[model samples]
Target: MESAELRELLTPEGVALLDSLPPYTSSTDVLKIVAGLRKDGYSASLVATVLTQAKLRGKAVAKFGDFAQRMLFTEAGLEQATRLPVAALHAGRYVRAGLTSVADLGCGIGADALAFAGAGLQVHAVDADEVTAAITTYNLSPFPEARVSHGKAEDTDLSDVKSVYLDPARRTSGHTNTNRLANAEDYSPSLDFAFGLAEKLPTGIKLGPGFDRDLIPDTCEAQWISVNGDVVEVGLWFGPLKRDGITRAALVMNAEGLHELTAATDSTDAEVGELGLFLYEPDGAVIRARLIGDLARSIGAHMLDEHIAYMSSDVAVSTPFASTFEVVHEFALDVKVLAKELKSRGIGTLEIKKRGVDIDPAEFRKRLSLSGKNSATLFLTRLGERRVAILAQRL
Candidate 1:
């Protein structure tokens, strides 16, 4: 956001106008709103700013929930900010570790800072963008002890800080619609500088789930966190923040509850065996953390292929770490044969899953000529040396 726009947004008139707006939706008559606001003598810039904020708030519900209504956001900031629930989890770690004074370097829109303050910890939220820092200041206004500063994450003074949390920027610098940066070294604060601080103070670094595990420091705990089945981030914790004997972990959160699988070191992949009565698909975070062996052991499952992440077992095990399906029948990879079988079974609604295969599910679905009232999951994968499709039902 520009300084002029920030000035207007921080004003009482802007605040009241934004608060008065009805909840925004895709169906909202944006043109009507603009005409009405302009007819009321509001400046074009103010109208645009408030409307953008209203729209962003509508989209931010998935991350901030109700708190989004009272917050400000930049396109990039909202997109990059940590989800509120996940930020709370990060704050809980600090509180549990007795690190009450932590610096949040590269704090985007102050999501973590908000959680830190809400958890009753002193927060020092720093960002490279001056406007973002100003907006963060407004967002953290309720907490007198929470400080917001405009500065480089690597250069920020941390003499008084107890612990540190860094979420390096992974996109080109901008307040809106910025392009993503792929190289780890290109991230703001740079991986080198961010990882160097971990050697000194207790620290937690938030990274993309697909970040190179080989690049991870040897001493820190590597934890991949998934929320509602989506692996959101992989956090590396060092020093006092690292859990004892838990260098590798997968934290899965869903309707059932939060489930964690941790190991002191990488787990050996489960031994391969013949496909069994049930197939287990480990959560993405589990696979990312390289803890599939632990999950397999927990559920009495064995790998279906030595190289594949899929596992199976004769016993139907109930666990949140993996989704289980009961096998019905296996068919040769011939599409006509499978289509005939599915049609005969009256299978209409199909949930297609595949691994170790090359086929588009959507295109393949069309070829199935599906027309029925029943639903079933079809797993198209290879077993040993044969390509087969297994019909299964959720257990």
Candidate 2:
């Protein structure tokens, strides 16, 4: 059914009717429902409609809170669905820089639209899917002035857009085919196409955290955004209005968490590698910012390799900017011997990390007979000219 029809069916009475059906007790139940829906040719809109209706019928709200949370928001958009702090931050930055209007292409569910409107800027919210347009319209109900339209990203006119905001459809509707945008060329509304639109105005593109850095435009500024410690999204900024280079932003959001960041460019000094007593892995946001070298310098730590993301130092840094761990043991070589030694040490629990190593961590852990009492991290990597296993503990 169309979103309008779905909305009509969402009336309290209609919702109650659907809710009267059997409730899913667990993730398995939800999965089974999804599978059955898929088999029955149910669309994403239909699935969400069913789920929402189920929730409205009081589908064990307290007991299945996690499942409901994931189903309702995380799988939908969660905070991203609302696009509060991120959009607010972006809008505030641009507003400070004298930007006034935005063309939010692919404005799914109006998260950024509402943010832009709330920021007191005129916005043109566009989405290709009618259902998404409806969702955006509903989400932006409070912001009636934000113009929501349905059209392909390329078809949307950019005449009044001072800063074009693009959030490409990174995945298909079913949440399958995660690599949908693996190639800029593969994007239905391709990145190259978005870049073309961006070249005409100051542009911001909200991207997946796992996006390939090599493909991003050289002139654009890349930002990795993390909320409380989890990296959420990566945004690329373009035009003369933006600060040049990569910026890592650590945002603590609760409608009130203080935000701090480090914005560094490719021109910054190259970082050197040194093995210290402790090692650190920068948060996903920091890594996405392409400011690993800058962060290493700030922490007075060194990199494991110029290209690698790990940082090391003997000095303990209490900052939450990166995940810190202490190196408990190091081996020059020997997967088999190392495994045997760990097994003998009553180390049955293993968490393996690798950089430039092709071995599967799970398979390697399985090769060793590990027990639950001893949990250790095995870093398979190259330091200088040797393959080594460095055991580490969270610090």
Candidate 3:
């Protein structure tokens, strides 16, 4: 959004109009609301701003929950903003470490800053973009101890700050149609500068979960976080922020709350063994943290293949680190034979899951001419050099 439009949106009259609008549901609903506002003599800019914010607020509910109603967001900012619950965890670290102040560099829309301030720490939130900085200032206005500045993160003053939080800009420059930058060097302020800051002071660097592991510093503690089964980001904690004896960690947050698995170093691969009666699929966070071996060992499971992440065990053991499945059938990978077998067993609906194979599940399903009364899951993968298919029921 343009600076002028944002300025208008923040006005009392505009905010009241935005608040008066019904919850945004679809494009047709938005169009009808816009038409009515225009008919009521609202300016074009005000109408556009209200509509944009209404739609953005609806989308923001997933990240900010009820607080989204009072927040403003840019499309890119909303996409990059950390979820409120996850940000609270980051803030809790600083609180536990006894850090009194933090500098949040590249603080998009001030989501993290708000969390830190709510935790009673002084926050210096900075964003290089004018609109983002303005929005951040507004978002943080309620906190007496928090401040916002429009400046480059690398150039921000940190002499008095007790610790730092860096979330580098990983998206291409644009107000729309932005793409993610896959290379670390492409990040604003650069990974090199960010790592240097971490080495000098207590710092937390938020990076994509798929970041290149080869470049991670040996002195830092890396934590992979997954929320509701999706691996979201990998956080590199440095100096005092790095917990004692913890070098690698996987933090899983689901409906049951947070569960963490930590190791002093990366776990070695579990020994490969024959397929057992049960299959275990390690959580994405566990796999990214390189703690799959630790998880396998905990459940007395062995790898199905040395190269693959799937695990197997004869006993039925329940664990939160992996999704367990009961094996029902196993056979050579032949589509015709599999289809005939499934048809005879009255299995119609299939959930095809594959790894170590090149077949597209949807296309393969279409070719099967499936028809039956039941449903089952099919796992097509290679057992060493031979192709195999395993039918299983999710536990």
Per-candidate Cα lDDT values, in order, are: 0.93, 0.68, 0.90
Structural similarity to truth (TM-score) of each candidate = 0.96, 0.77, 0.96
Runs of candidate 2 with Cα error greater than 4 angstroms are: 1-12, 15-48, 52-83, 172-179, 210-215, 228-230, 244-264, 267-274
* Total backbone collisions for each predicted model: 0, 2, 0
Candidate 2 accuracy as TM-score: 0.77
Q: On residues 144-235, what C-alpha lDDT tens digit does candidate 2 reach at each position?
A: 77888999889887887778888887665531123344555665578888788677888888887788878777777676677666677777
lDDT of 2: 0.68
Model 1 misplaced regions, further than 4 Å: none
lDDT of each residue in 60-165, candidate 1, tens digit only: 9999999999999999999999999999999999999998899999998999999999999999999999999998998899898999999998789999999999
lDDT score for residue 123 of model 2: 89
